[model samples]
Target: MRMVTKKQVPPLLLALGASVLALVFLLAFQGWIAHGADIFLSLAQAGLSWCF
Candidate 1:
């Protein structure tokens, strides 16, 4: 006879993790993250231009 063990995650912890992931996805879909990235990229380009 073979014995099998299954591991289960707590529902509260799973729900919290899922909520955080959903929030990040929502922000990304709404372009909030992209807006910050665009600002950072523009600043980097300006700094490099000054160095050149």
Candidate 2:
């Protein structure tokens, strides 16, 4: 049996794939996701405040 080497995913392609998945989730759960995003942003802001 021959060993097969794994190829790296290109950055643009990876970003596109992630964007597609995010779009799907957004479409499926717009309200819940929006609420979660708001909570996440608030937490991020709090963390950044401590850093600055």
Candidate 3:
């Protein structure tokens, strides 16, 4: 019987993960995500204010 002690992550997988993160940041910086986040935050704040 043989046992595997260690597992390795592929470089391609790491590169893909980094690229996806970078794309998300790029979009956020361009206001694609920031706009949506602003709307969400304002709605949440309004809702909280109305509750009190």
Candidate 4:
């Protein structure tokens, strides 16, 4: 019997990271992230600001 007591990252954060990675991959495939990087970046910046 193994005692796995190590704490793990929260499931929600894991899921969010996975989803974000998938979205990044999809955008890369469409060349949208590269071409419109500034636009998306600004959106992300705005979103972060909204949290404060």
Q: Best by TM-score, which number?
A: 3
In candidate 1, stretches whose alpha carbon ends up further than 4 angstroms from where it belongs are: 32-52
lDDT of 1 by residue, 19-44 (tens): 99999999887786558667667778
Q: What is the lDDT of residue 49 in candidate 3?
A: 35
Candidate 3 error regions (>4 Å)? 1-4, 32-52
RMSD of each: 5.8, 8.3, 4.8, 9.9
Q: Model 4, range 1-52, lDDT digits (tens) per residue?
A: 9997988999999999999999999978788646566766687887853442
The lDDT for every candidate, in the order shown, is 0.80, 0.80, 0.78, 0.79
lDDT of 3 by residue, 1-52 (tens): 9997887789999999999999998987788555766766777877853442
Alpha-carbon lDDT of model 3: 0.78
lDDT of 2: 0.80
Give model 3's TM-score versus the native structure: 0.51
Candidate 2 local lDDT, 1-52, one digit each (tens) = 9999999999999999999999988787877666866766777878853442
Comparison by TM-score, 1 against 2, better one: 1
Candidate 1, pairs of clashing residues: none
Give me the displacement of residue 17 in model 1, in angstroms.
1.2
